[model samples]
Target: MHVTDACGRGGATPPSRWDPAEPDPVAGLLATARRRLGMDLCWFSRLIGGAQVIEACDGDAAAFGVHPGSTVHHPGPHRSHALAERPLPVVGRIRPEAVTSGTATEATGTAATGVEATGGPLAGRPEVGSYIGVPVTLADGRPYGMLCCLSRDADVAMPARKTRSLALLAEVLSASISDRRSGGEYREAAWWRIWRLIDSGGPTMVFQPVFDLPSLDCVGAEALARFPPGSGGAERWFADAAAVGLGPALELSAIRSALRAFTCLPPEFGLGVNASPATILSGRLADAIADIPADRLVVEVTEGDRVEDYPSVRCALGVLRREGVRIAVDDVGAGYASLHHLVQLQPDFIKMDQCLTRRIDADPARRALAAALVHFAQETGSLVLAEGVETARELGVLIGTGVHQAQGHYLAPPGPLPLPASANRTRPPDTA
Candidate 1:
């Protein structure tokens, strides 16, 4: 929360913000409701494959002209301002207004977290469920949004208990976001609720200074998202996100948070962000990058967990490429299967993972791996990036291998990055 509330004694509610929604009624009610609905997207648009859906979205999805949902997205008049006009940042949940119907039938065991939208570019988009969002706030309220579950099913109306529960959640959500007492407020807190811990003016960002190997000049910046509050460290906060099924949500929030900080960066530098394959598959990536200048951004696909669907991941990456976002295969040599993904993706940049970069001057095996990755990148006309260059000797070896870029503590540790006074004026040596 960005607001400054005067006279403390704010209050407490036992983290029990609100009760969760109850299940919806049985199948008969759902079927009847779904049948009553008129003209859905599939019915309105001509039958085309996912490609056609993509074509429609690319052509005109925003106008709601491209495709209609199985049910109307805005059933009646636009009622968003009601929930949206608050100060809390809506994180894990959807907007209250977007609530359509809740299910009492059975839990599909799927999460409410945003997912890869399906079909075209619009497919696998984050937030597929019916929902609405609005921000709530305390005094110095930094307005946030709410993600409320409108309806459990696309066609059904949510039960009264569910709506009431969601509404209760909305209220607590507002308070949780607005309650920014001190650094220790987030320990053991719900991960999504951790948004309240967002530092002043929202979350802060540090741009890892990236040096072009041959030129040894600052050519780009990798945006590293870090929260200032320590109620829980980065690992804890990140862990919470995964627990609440909001890994992608947090990642997207971090990217947007990074972008807000990016405005201060020197315009010439390309901005890079660590992106996960999970997010790419969910599909709102294009929507996320739609506002950013494609020429100035590089989305490094850092694989965590595992690459479940390479084809889908590749397809999403291809779209990003088509849109001009540079792709980088991060941690190239750390994973045994990395090379295969690298070869398949044919990324614009291949970052030598820190495992291989650390102590490379003394390790023959690491050096060999580095050499092989560099050779592959060069052969494919892709630039090589060497991260974790913590020593002069290590840097020397990287320069010798003809690696294209380097970043690490020796050059710069991840800090509130704007090229500190020591770094802003300094330049990398011209190894070429």
Candidate 2:
């Protein structure tokens, strides 16, 4: 059966109505919830024709016939159906007799419903011993579906805090669904394309040289994520991923892909990877670069999301620093926060943003600001790197300002491979 859109307009399509073979973001959320919550199974179902139809599921739910595209009839008073009718979360233990005998009669007494129950699919399942669920609702307060988990252990219990956590997960699912519908066909199509790109490992890794300005020698190469030839620019692709709540996942994937090129890079050059503060705090970054020599890796924190807990972030970075991993703050001089981050983190390197680097030769104010940053970095013992040197004049001004390192189209563009060692010292003309 086709799922109706939240708008109740016949033309709007629901997530459930999409092709079953397509990847459902809700499925990923359900799987994550199940693993995080240590539940036997988790599934998302929508109410259709007085029954619950499983649209996405994870774990062992499929063993009991709770698979995607499967329909389970839950008459008027079944606990699962009753939970879906409300807008709040519900959690309760299933009686042992319900699973032992595959009967609803004994379990009905413990159910959170005020109405009597007729036998339903959930009642016949001899595996589910407890249930916790949150109603998925639309922006207009209408119920869209339910995100629920079931466990086979009768003694299983969920804390009050866990209920709230489940509610938040449900809200994320609701928002993702709403985005798909509200974004119209173009956005929905774009989401699918990006989803495929990520799933197929569509991004290719390229390295651009970062040069030490005074010595005119390449000291490092920043790993940049490049999509397929016709897949559009990197910025647009990343923006779309962020819009769909897949930003961190994609960034992590890119980092992992970039690391594969470590062996190909020259031993003297540090491998730089761009990551947001959120990704840095996740601790997964540590694992991604763990095998490589820590001193050869530079974690350049990109200015994407704001850091909420500076102390926690500092502690995480400290652990990596102890292992010889260095940190670099990207896009400095672009905003006040970047300067604040410089002081708080005391990174090993500070990268000047392109906004300040572009046309630095013509702008005295920018030159002064760059010089000041250079002096600050000098005093703090942090090396300053000027980014986006597109012209000879910009490079000359950056060099005059005592910027230790610089990189841009003027030096080299990202390529499938790093420039050979012989070409590292001489400044290459703008290739683009």
Candidate 3:
């Protein structure tokens, strides 16, 4: 996808794949994200749609890591109305924190005058007096983008306009984030805002239905986190934590939240929690590891974030695994490292990324990856859990592949905990 530079200028040339005038494909991709979270919802907003990558903050955004041909989209007073329909207004890119804080509904100006984000684009535009916008989030708790409204010479936030309308619009904004993952780009900003809430501990947990192939019954859960509006948001929670090198702290806190949230859950239910390599590889994780009840943990390792050394990470993982902690190489096939890691660390679990899991029924390549992952996990004595299962056909393929468990919307959205258990239930003890 495209990322805007700090100056709001796209530079000498625009992105090859992106036409700022037509971000629908990107928007459509974003709309497809289905967040079934227990805490505040995890956004896949277009930010999640195509999603944003934190550049190293070197050179232009493209050098940082923006996708090919993608340039940032600007929403000015002239372009403000466009947001009414599209919602997520991509700006020239900035720091991840700026993305989060900017997307939240912090009014730019007080009602002293009738304006939304005062001194904003609309302010300079003729007859513009008000503005409004919401941030989007990604599945991993990053800002996606935003949707907003503006009223020329009118108070957009005026209390007299049947405040409930604003309430309805807020609800609409909320729903849009959930809906956008499937096809809307506008929700990207909202998704980010949601993350900021989670980062702040506003988001809680939900356990979703995960199935076991042998039993053909529900077994474990994907530990999903959610955030509510007015919360600190995932950005502040995770990004700031990252900036200060406290990812492990946030992760530990999230695990505690899950423990409290899932305490009543049956022993058979396992919760999948997101983790970063930095958190995993950090020497300090011993204490964090000690805090997690060994029985309840199903750590999913997402590679999208930083991980300096693989061998050391594997050793750290070994330490946890030795303690009866079940380990998972999450999002395999979604990035570059899993295979090397799979060979080096040989985790107790392998969560095939949804990109590979999505069309397995129709695509042979996906099926092969599923099969290979299953074989690798089996050889390593690790369980295979395919994440983001969205289709019955995909489920059937997973079963055919001999995966130990499955998670995704095909069964149900990630939501509140304590799903019922049966003989086929996920074996928490088995994880160790």
Per residue, candidate 3 scores C-alpha lDDT tens digits across 53-139 of 221111122222223322223334313433343333221211222323323122343311121221222212233233333344434
Q: What is the full ranking by lDDT, best candidate first? A: 2, 1, 3
lDDT of 2 by residue, 172-230 (tens): 88887876656555556665676566556547888888887776777778999988887
Give the per-residue Cα lDDT of candidate 1 at 129: 34
* Clash statistics: count for each candidate: 51, 0, 66
Query: lDDT of all predictions, in order shown?
Result: 0.55, 0.73, 0.51
Model 1 is weakest, by summed lDDT over 10 consecutive residues, at 50-59
Winner of 1 and 3 under TM-score: 1
* Candidate 1 lDDT tens digits, 175-200: 54445332123422663365454322
Ranked by TM-score, the better of candidates 1 and 2 is 2
Per-model TM-score, in order, reads: 0.53, 0.58, 0.49
Worst 10 residues of 3 by lDDT: 33-42
